[model samples]
Target: MAKKLWVERNEDGSWDAYSDDGAHIKFGHGKGLFNPGDLMKVALAGCAALSSQFPIENALGEGKGARITVDGDYDEATDGYTAFREQVVVDAQSAGIHGDDAEKLKDRVERHIEKSCTVKHTYEVATPVTMKVKVITK
Candidate 1:
């Protein structure tokens, strides 16, 4: 299923991004909005969590999820991020997974995330993006 997404500039000078499924996010250079870089970080973190969700829940019982945090340093000269660090935190001890079992689970989850996260893979491959501009006349 191909999903459509778009962004619109608001009257207040901020931008609103929307998906066909009714998802909306306030973005751009604003006080409480997410910038482009923030969105990229969030996408990577979300992809990691989702990729590992099934394995994590299976090992730690249903509803047990992992928290993923993604951070990076942006270089002004290049206008891009230098590196991103993603940390996935799962409390195996609380779920009765310990010692060797915990280590095994950790390794399994990492492998799953590494194999399944498309967003991370895209970033790793540095996917090419093309932009087009249209002019409207009255």
Candidate 2:
């Protein structure tokens, strides 16, 4: 299994994520004000991007690469959100392969990533959540 990564929040509302291999990355409020949920999207995009290259190369041969861009539309109320939409463009090609083939390859790659990515998997499972809030009068 691949090694795990960890992230910790400091007292000042900043965070540092570290890989098991000893790499550290800073994230949070001033350095980009995003939560763990937002970072999951980035992770999904990155996983999809890397996974896409394999099949394109298999069908089109080596020296071909693909660029994948992912987006999503979410409504906070329903949570029946479209998690990701990927736009993939192939930069190199082998004989007899055209844009249509590239698109199909993109679809295949997308499906593979959806099935394999950890963040995407998290979205597929509905976790039980409870919320409580307190109000104070000044």
Q: For this target, which candidate reaches the highest lDDT against the unseen true structure?
A: 1
Residue pairs with backbone atoms closer than 3 Å in model 1 (clashes): none
lDDT of 2: 0.70
Q: List ranges where model 1 is wrong by over 4 Å.
A: none
User: Model 2: per-residue lDDT, tens digit, 44-107?
Assistant: 7677666666776777777665666666788789865656665666654445766787577667
Question: Would you list the clashing residue pairs of candidate 2?
Answer: none
* Candidate 1: Cα lDDT at 113: 91
TM-score of each: 0.93, 0.58
Please give the lDDT score at residue 123 for candidate 1: 88
For candidate 1, write residues 1-138 as lDDT tens digits: 889999999999899899999999888886998899999999999998888998899999898889889999999999999889999999887887888998988898999998999999988876788989999999
Question: Each candidate's lDDT (Cα)?
Answer: 0.91, 0.70
Worst 10 residues of 1 by lDDT: 120-129
